[model samples]
Target: MAGISKSFFKAEPGQLVESDGELFKITHLMSISSVLAVNIKTNESVRLHVENLVPISPTEVTEKKYEERLHPDLALFSDDEWAEAQRRFQAIKPLLQNPIRTREDAETIATKHKIHPATLYKWLKLYQDAGHVSSLVPTKRGRKTGTKLLASEQEKIIESAIEDIYLSKQRHKPQDVIEEVLRRSRLAKIPPPHPNTVRNRLAVLSPANTLRRRGFKEAARNKYAPILGQFPGADYPFSVVQIDHTEADIILVDEAHRKPIGRPWLTLAIDVYSRMIAGIYITFEKPSATSVGMCLAQAICPKREYLAEVEVGGEWSVWGVMGTVHTDNAKEFRGTVLERACEEYFIDLQWRPVMLPHFGGHVERLMGTMANEIRKLPGTTFSNPTQRKGYDSEGMSALTIKEFERHIVEFIVNVYHQRVHSQIGMSPKQKWELGVLGDANSSGTGVMPIPADPLRIRLDFMPFFERSVQQYGIQIDGISYYDKVLDPYINAADPDNPKAKRSFLIRRDPRDISKVYFLDPVDQRYVPLPYRNIGYPAMSAWELREVQQTLKTQGMRNVDEHMIFEALDRMRVRIEEAKQKTKAARRQQTRIPLPKLPVVVFSKIHSPADKSMNQNERNFGMAEDDPFAQPIKPFDEISIIR
Candidate 1:
């Protein structure tokens, strides 16, 4: 009200007032024009008045900017850090004297806290609107404005540079490229450009269908340009895991052929909170749910203790639901399967706009790093290595496929991870552990104008019991659950009452009719696989184990209490026997079975009688014991032995 007019339509929010001697010029109005109270000093004693008024002119108005309350050095943050502080701020705001209402208020809060205005706004919005807070921070100021140098010019320069480099197959200096550009411009009647100008132009133009840090950006130039992405220290895991898919070349051995397969798909997820890779999926094809599923499973699955023994500082200490997930707007991702999965997992799929991939730069970078470094293994091929011009998938040159692949995989899992990550300068595994242990928030949802936490994810978020479906209202084990239950929860029962059926919705697997996963409210985790699903659950594992003990107590072990289980037990035993008998020791196994040879005999023929008693006798006399003469002959075929 200091500067604004009383009329609702005439006044603007934050209109500053300037004062002249005879008259007053409205400076600025507070955000809410109706909520102004003025304290005026006619003499020395000031009186407070709640009235419709406008801000006075220059004489009364002064340019006032209080020193941004120096934040606790600990509280100060880069633009990325503001989101988290804001989240904490929202939860703690009720404890503060003022509630946020305007951009100025948010800025003021950021000033006081030594953070970004976007951060404060995100925090305050959650508090005022939904009464819940999110962890995502606002984007940093230095983001790509898309205010790039002219594209046609950029292309012309690149073409000029590449033409020379490709023809010579050598690296060209910046000066050389600039000279070529100038020379061409002169011939073409275009303006001559500076060398630095050409390099700056190149930095802005990232390659199509690829993610690469612009190495040409001179560090000193445009320091205020948007930074890509950042994460606070290992505060929490899964706050905002970024999922993305890109084609990369990884040497995969085809076990069938004992040779390298085609280029592989790289599906990767990075924790925005920790700036760490929570999961990695590498395959030799366009990435699919099968690929994503593997990566996601790794991320959500509990980290085992043996990790510490295998790798240093591998221990993970915390686990739970992440606040939100960021992904690209790919058709496969928009389908019902992924949407339903996120709903069931209590995860929000925050898909970026189509073709606007820089929004997910972190994961994209990880992909580039894995490919660029690992693919350039000793024997790995590139389309234009010396010139850095283009990509060539099938190599014209032959490399030892086996040796190349072995080194590549080994390098990724061990050597690359051991090296410093680009964003945080920490190993991916190390950052990942930090997130899992700390329950920090990392979400873009926090940046929404309104609070997002209180938005109870809709019931239609796949696999929940809907009130419209009756068949969904069946009992499982001892509890009554459904796909959707009627408003009355007609089949619902008291959880405390043993005779009653406790009601809930179920998520049946579309791929397999044999499996159904129940949402267990106790641990906030999914059911371990192979858990039996009854219409009404009889009891938890602890309860079931006790019942088994009781059955032993009653001496009913021989009797088939559950025929279903009894049949399973019998089947299992049979399978085990078959496996044991058919399986033979490696050394004892025969290559092929042999058949016995049939025996056959033929008549013998006798040789003509001859005598060898005398050296030159007219005829050799028939002799029974003559050494030089053939006394008898045996003919025809005979089976040798066996």
Candidate 2:
């Protein structure tokens, strides 16, 4: 009684209690002022004030029972309690048989159940509303089921804090999130939940989802985004080919002086199905449309003559018209000439999506493999500075450009084509043959044959320029070109725009600037236009620029064609001197084999004077069959006088 309250006594019905050291069992809790009980030893009823009563044993009320007593409005009782309530209803059913219940009947039922008079009517109303005995049971205590702080204003404050402060680029931690949640809750005049509860909620989110919400879209896409697999249609050889460009890791020396030149760029094409190296173009120039064109042309043409030129021991027969060509979003791959060439060959060109490297993985992997092999060579830069820190790549350089090209050709034909690839489980050459032959155990795909006219493909991939035909000839790159076949188109007005000059399509081979191919609109045939200076040496655009630079460095004023050629001859002599003096040049000259001169179709055409000239004099201004030949004098200086 000293510790208990009056309300506590009222809730202790059917509980054992002690009064004046006598144990008693509480029969009923009449009111907060009085409680009725029977003595356990004497079995006599006694009425006592709640202040004089003390509980001997507290009632063992379960969660369900306590909940029922706290909220008696809803149905949330146990099975035994509901059955007892149903029995009480059945007993009162006879009293209200006529369906006309009165106060007397309600009072009688309340007395029979030992409950309050108003509680009986409440039960009857609940029974009528639910039409079931379960409705008579009392509702559970505390907040109702599905009702908590989650639906309260405090939860809204926490969620707003999470969205505004936590899910930001700053990437706040969970403790920071909790602090912000508390601050917002206090600002909104609401109590915040525990920190652990908020942490539990945040734990449900995935790391990717969190990064996507907090970090920028591009970062999230690069780090967490899913990668797409190979294109679905790339199941057969020549079905899909991937093309890409990479700078070789090895530094090369010039053929003439053997001076250390910068690394060369390589444009490579790989067949997706067989994992075969289809085409490759290596040059000291930067990657451009010319490189793409050259690589694709080499891939489409027969490689028998090329193999002989490179002196490869093994057979490299892989060549054909690819069904689809896949490449990156580089400007070189998207050139107008490349698109036109692909269209002419009935090939589909597909550009991979931006920022996705997996689309061109095959070619990229091949480049990596080749770069690894190059690292083993003497003049290799070794990919990065870490691997090349102590090595003197420039000083140890021994291979010239021509020798390196031969080495690459040999590696591709003899080594890479014969080794077993990890993905294909067989050599690239073997897989290619199997795919072409349609072997039952292979991919079972037939290969398309190479085009009938190989020279047409070579002409198609050449870089072109728009020029106007004049009486003198079409001037290109500060050089005048003339041919008798352009007689009809010379001085013609443009049919599309009369005010504008008539433009004709002209294709040039950068490797040889002696002539240009003029596309005749009337007959749709290419005509060769030779340079005005027929005595000029057959040199590349690179060589011409080098010659110009050499003359400028020599303090030559008002440089002309004669001055450029004179400086070029002098530079040739200096290169020969260096070749004999430099250690790199001496080593290269001894170890590397001499390469044959590349043949061009335009070289077949000969002038009248060329036929009369002896073989020694004809070496210059004719095909470069002799590498050590001297430059010929001007055509006017050489007169037969016969």
Candidate 3:
């Protein structure tokens, strides 16, 4: 006992210890008092002398013991019998530590521990041979084979049934698959598997594999395939720009009449590196090559007084030639004009692979965020009709185009740009500055400058048409344009063939039909050509088409310039009537207006016909007129009636 005690170490708190042939867990160690506070097997608390305590190993305390001496078959033993066996083994543990050379020696040690000599010798031999306490634990006493249904032939049948019947588009049940397996097994003269066994086997199949087997390739890919890699980000501002177009969820009214015009399409460009919006264009026109061109033009050109015009107070400052433009495979993005425009500016154009939306996720996400903001506005259609159910979007729409544009500008500058972006961990404005300057307080001397020849770039992106200069003027889509700039090219012969009439490349802004740009081949300069009927009001391509359709509906022939203008006038009257009738328009009239800078009006030399026309004709003649223009009221003296 003394020898054993000398070899044994002090037991710590929470250690399993043996005292008086009973297992006790040391709850606390009172080193000062040389006593251990212990919980007995029955969970009774008691204090014991530290000298009497011997630490028991976790394996000895927890592991079940068996009756079999060598590789004991523990399966036959009940829980009480196993526990008794473990106690017996623990009793003989101290004696086994000393070597027993003979049967007499084993008998002496067994007598001291109160165990049979034969049993003692057997346990000693077993412990010596295995050299591990776990080896003393007996396994279950039976053939350790798993279910007989897992045989190769049975497994093959089960797998075949699962593939053919269970994992299918029809979504066959597990019981049906089991039945199919049983039927197949019966035909082959093999014993049928239990239904539960078949179900367990089928349950092991992965969800992705099941989906794939059911002909859901996309679902399988989404569930099991690795996520798409992050976009190879740009190092500097404008190194990569992503552009996309989305229809705004909110309905907007015309600036003049304040009647619901419908949802406007917005083309937006975002700088990939800084996550800053480079430019945006909002219009009622559908997304086309012309829209893309207009967006790109705005993106590259330096923003002048646009912020002021929109009543926004921050410096937008984002502008420059993009090194690379990334976009999805939209018709507008794939147009030759867009390609040529990019090529002219040495910009690399990349189209994302089909169905891989993650490539252009930055711009797409920006558009989504913008749409969510728009959904909070007064007249949002809420992305889809399901979400817009019970909401009167058209009736609630109270924002004019100019007002909406201002709100968007304000949101971009004051809200979106200033908010800390989750991905970048900084505001877009800060990121833009960091990307441009590399350090806080540093000037943006390294920023890429805007193109020197902005007009040339603009002309390259504008929608163009090939027309010959006739004796009267160049007729474009039923409208004739004339300018002194076209005089040099008038009746000009083709350089290649003298007899053939020369065709000139004419560029026009869809937003304004009052003027067109004629590319002069001789000097390579664009010549601005005004409409032949200068009095004809500037109209968008969409408005012009609408008026043309209206005329066609009315069965009106001779769709001349005068008739077109008259149709526009009639449409204006209808729009005004709609404004007066609409509850939304009346609500808009009551909202307090924001303070704006005085609009700068540029003097224009009116044509003879424009001078002779009324004030309404002059108001809508140019596309550049103040969008927030108000009708002038005639002055009258105040009368005091008695």
Candidate 4:
């Protein structure tokens, strides 16, 4: 086994790479997406996709230590040797930024610089392979030529000046460093090194080391640290996805009143391999299982109908249950509800390694990018108080949650997905398509399998309660739901306990209790059960609680379903009346809290083996008693706009 630096994926010519248990020498980098390599033993040439290459770990290599070779001491070269190296660096510098694609291109550059094309290619190979100027220093055959033989005192003086003056918190200028070295040399009664020598030494100091010594350790790590090799397992699209939450840096207005409400939290999922936005969940609600469920559900399902509803003219093709859902160790991600649901769906749920934030680098970086985009909006809070100082974020609030969501989707589909990603050297959508469909150089894994029962998958992630069905239907948190679908289990007794009622599985989307789901015991399929009375206005669990508390304050003791609906109507009227008079009312009424969960009342059933449920035909229709201002759209056209 041999270890390879992750940078080898860039596939510079002259670099050795291993694929499929044989070694190949990269001859040319054709483009970001393609490479040309020749077998070392057989001399047979083959093309490859950059993505098909694996990062070679240094620990596995026994023949050579690549790290030591890549980083050599600049002091080893004499003045003339360093100058020749500098000349070679200057000749190839332009090509580093605008790389030559073929031998003809290299020949053109060689002719312009008056160097033979073969010599230019050799210089390019060494520089690109090591990514340093020192790699260009000509190797000496015998005793090193032009080697600087300085006395111990003079050498110590130069070293001290570089470390203490040039690379200190004060960040002294290069001229200041030269002067310090000269002054020290004068005091010690020693000959001083040339100014060019001092400058060359400064240039050879590792950029990361220089930055760290100058008080920019974090920036150094961000710019220079090895990232791809550190976190593994994201081998292809949908192999590993990172999901996380952050408060959006923009104020939002209420849909109805159009007044400043507050900032909303955004839960985002990004596929690490492609850096594509797998799914997004934005709401006024705090981060909870509800948010995670909605985000994951969106990630695993198609988005054609959703795009139509949002009126965004673009395709968001990334979907399907990911191989693993990676998230931080937050309590919301660790809840039993989420764990159980992922387990049932065969999705691997992994937590970030304890105390290691870099494990979540993908999602965190995506959040930063989204934040940067959001800060440009009119009502942006701008990330911090200093950035927001003198700015009127609340007063400038214009977009409602729905409007903001539309903007985010448009940005993701049109702008972000189309831009070239620095690390992958291609757009996210391009990477995603390549991973799915493949190309001439490699084979794709194919698109992931779409979940057959979207609604059941959603329900599994939502909060659940085990309650025994009764004649009046199911009651949850004092709200009752009824339908003929639950008749089999009505007053059903537990087989294990003859004296006690059998508890059945019931789940609800807290945002809307107008309907709840019943996991029928006999058939193992979920049944949608609307409210027992059916006339209640669709309201969130928060609003329901507010109504319940208001009734209690007004001296009403036993609240019924009818009383709740009647109170809701009055509350809406009061909200409308007060909205114009006070900002608090407008804020309270900011969001209607439309069901964030999918409209899957008519969706198909879960068919995992041994999953028992009653054999009754699933009644896939809005309850006859339920009232609606408009007809509920057929399930096929249903879309979760958020």
Candidate 5:
């Protein structure tokens, strides 16, 4: 009797052990270790040198019972079984003849007939729900088919449905699953649950009553698990954290604004390890340190605690001190005053290595995710101004640019940090918690802090320059800068010379730091300069380009001799016009008032319904001077139809 079960479904796990019945045919079997369990079925852990291994069902307690109801041909019940079924049906004819109108009536009749009334009632419900009107209807059915399930059961069903649909699953409808469960339970003489109960459970599970896919393809993902770790920031509420600039959109006046308030560059910061945003500030401008300062102030500066998790009167901080601050070589980040502040806090200034910009790639990715996630919140609006300004780091309000940011941070601290990450089956918060558990506190080797200098912070930011066609030396802020090594360029222009004209793009190097190099064409050679000490100095290429464009537009330069001749000729013409105007003025005497213009009126003139106007004629033009205008004589107007 091994490897045999499922003739009747045993609902309770323990009950399955007692039912010694067999149903499914193992036609496709070689040697089954375990049904649906890949690991045990493969037997990979312990390799056996046996020529044959047999699959034996040691415990026949499974709910996934199969049926031969599936058919390639319209097969029916066998001759004897059908004949016996007909005989049993005829024997039970009187119960059908006098239909019991109520459960009580059925029970009374059932007691007399020695039949289980509950069984008869269930069959009736099953028949009714399936449009058969028999006695097997589930217990949870009446008017509300889908709404009969309990809340927890509803949620479970919805979640299960979503997962199944995502896999393009078939075979089990909610009703079908319910019917099978009932069949199994009743087969073992256990009371079956109602269809309404199952339906109600599904309703509480999801009101939408539909399945949606998260749209991730496991096959396309890299064949490696995600590497996960943590980088802890401050400990107090928001004591000190690094603010990185990014842009995100959100809804404001909705219809008036059409889409969300866009062009709003999002400035936000996160606690390194918890991945929580300390604060956020958004504006319609280039992201700056000042904005970063504002966002940080909102986060670090304690205003109030609406509902305190910890005690009051203390600085609101989940992150307490600024540590080895990490950032790219952005100008806003490189300010000397900001560096001074960091120094005061004893925070180390760590500029991610040039060219290796993605060293701070985690923050960059976080910023991207912030934008994407908040974009879903775009149709959401706030009730007040401060929230819109992104000034308040925390408060109770409908989601605003600011409120949404806070929500984002909370999600990070609560959900993202707590759950096992998709990449690594460990949380960022868990990692940090582990680190802290490793060491309660440090000695004199305190956590690293940033450098703070108020006047102007000095950050070793990446720098480069763009190639220039020297027009009387590159002038920056009206002070002329000379590439005095013009001789090198001249010498290289001669075909006989072995040097490529050393033209270079003088822009901030997205990579490389310390020195500026005037690299030659094709980079055959480079003229390095000790720019930090001396040699070359000019504003950023972005600034210089703006100035240069302004000067060009204002006509600061022209073809010298050609403009001079043109100017002389223009001056003579101006003199002649002045004399003519003077003469005309001398002869002028009286003034006359201007005449008024005739008013224009646009009034609709509906034509008589001879269907005079074609749809094109009605919409195409005005009364006069219309290109598509056709002259219709009063004598001839006709109507046509197809």
Candidate 6:
């Protein structure tokens, strides 16, 4: 399945494909990120994800190295086999549509086709996933259940040898395991199995299990995980989730100062199946791997705790591991950190095709809808300068970051999810329910699996780097992190090269760099490493960066860990001073501050007189009305049931 890689998922309208052995022609792309294909044999139309359709011509598939993508030859099917495939396709076609059918619908169709309702639905799923009519072909039954060519006693001997010799802390070689098995068989006076048969048994053992058992836990986590090649279509809930970033179209204010900071960047993920918002992360920081990771972690885990944290009342039910995360080929999205994290969770990460923006239509549409909602807020820039004409965007800026987050969550869970979508002919929440829980007309595919360890999932996606532990512990970006657990790996050398140090994986949340997680070699658990000198307060990576920049500007030739923390402390003092001055001035101003209708003011002081103005007066000059300073109550709290 060489060409059956991402190239095979390339689809266009009017292309011929085989589904359930029957031929079908792709009609057009659907709004829900799906494609419409009409069955050639029965003239029945069906909606399918592009992955569902297999290439009809043998020439379409090239040789591939991977074993997963199988390009079955449809030309070999006999006339009778093709007719039976057509019959199965027709029987299951109605169940493929949106607003999934009920048990009643399944029973009625099952009776007409002379098939069991359960069997009919199973066939529907097989065809849906493979997109080949061959999926419906009858299996040539031969072997009875639990039947094995070898005697049970011989099988037990082989299993024991594999467990003891192949899967051991000492890491025995394959040849060693086979020799041991043969020796044992001979001692029992039984015929020995072929070397390949023993090798085949070893191969059946899961790669992760084998690696972990052989004391290569790090390798098991990093190297042996599967990377899915094909992008499953947006045919089901969590099938394909798209994420993108945009600078929010409004100015936000600082909590204490009550003055505009700047527009924040919004990282949003939307499930293509039901047009539901899967996850969102908003920050003043530019788009980076951390933002992508945070957004994805939110999407994959439950949102109940998150909703409560944000103080939003409505339910956000769209959470799970998506089949494919479709994103643009930005540098952040292409990073190894994201790629490996997705792989560890069995997620297929697909990039949008070059020069095709339409491939990311769902997230783009959601962004637009969000922008429209943002326009109604107090400090909206309204998407353009023309729209903001005579409007006091900065002067009207009143909402703090927390307040703005509340509004966004309110809009997503309360307004957008509940509103009737024109394209889907139902609210996103309604469609999501139908897909997850099924309706009167169709059987529902249950919800996607929730992560067992939610915190671990979040930590897995955070920024990570590899560093060898030393006597002083690990130093990263001018911070020293240490814990007693690192003592075993201190100054550890690589097994392959004695002179080289072994680099251990360390992950840290950018939001708080006070500690870093060290991947312990002993138990393969993430050990928390706090600052060696814990007196320094916790600070963000962004704050550390700014302090480094300030030090360089002041002509500091050699900066160290202590210098960075000292600079951060000074910066924190400056922020506290600004907050105090703003609060004091508010007590004096009886009249509401006047609104300023402009973006941002960056100017040079022409004279010494201008420069001599106190910092308070300079900052307070840009302040707006007290009413604008108050927290915004944009919408009423709306609670939703699951």
- The candidate scoring highest on TM-score is 4
Q: Alpha-carbon error at 294 in model 4, in Å?
A: 0.8
lDDT of 5 by residue, 122-214 (tens): 444433222211112122434322322333444454445434532233524666656655555555565555666555444444221233222
Question: How do all models score by TM-score?
Answer: 0.33, 0.52, 0.53, 0.57, 0.27, 0.56
Residue 446's lDDT within candidate 4 is 56
By the lDDT metric, which is better: model 2 or model 4?
4
- What Cα-based lDDT does every candidate model obtain? 0.41, 0.66, 0.67, 0.72, 0.37, 0.71
Each model's RMSD to truth, in Å?
Answer: 34.3, 38.7, 33.9, 23.0, 37.8, 20.9
Candidate ranking (TM-score, best to worst):
4, 6, 3, 2, 1, 5
Model 2 TM-score is 0.52
Model 1 TM-score? Answer: 0.33
What 10-residue stretch in candidate 5 is worst by lDDT? 1-10
Candidate 4 residues 261-320, lDDT tens each?
A: 788999999999999998888878779888998899878765655666566777787766
- Give the candidate order by descending lDDT: 4, 6, 3, 2, 1, 5
Candidate 4: segments with Cα more than 4 A from true spot: 1-232, 549-559, 566-570, 590-642
Off by over 4 Å in 2: 1-232, 441-447, 495-501, 542-642
Q: Which candidate is the best by lDDT?
A: 4
Worst 10 residues of 1 by lDDT: 1-10
Which of the two candidates, 2 or 4, achieves a greater TM-score against the reference? 4
253-287: candidate 6 lDDT, tens digit per residue: 77556777778889999988899999999877779
Look at candidate 3 and give me any clashing residue pairs: none
lDDT per residue as tens, model 2, 518-616: 776654455677776777655566667777776667787766566666665675566556675664433323222233333222234466774686754
**Looking at candidate 1, what is the lDDT of residue 21?**
18
Q: After superposition, how far is residue 593 of candidate 1 from its true place, in Å?
A: 30
Put down candidate 3 lDDT per residue, 1-642, tens digits, no spaces.
000000113345676667788778867644312345556658887887554555566776557431112222112233334434454555456666454466676677788878788877677565444432333343446532132325668888988999889888888988889889999999988887778889877765667778887889899977754333333458778888999999899887755556676777899999988888988887666788877887787787555446755656766767767877888878888875676556435467777777989888899999999998999899899977899899999889988767788888889888999999999999998888777656655543243443333455566677778888986789887788887667777788965456779788777776666677766665445667777977676676666787899999999987887788788778766655656677443433322122222332334544455456555333332122222223232222211111
In model 3, where do residues sit more than 4 Å from their true spots? 1-232, 256-259, 383-391, 440-445, 453-455, 547-642
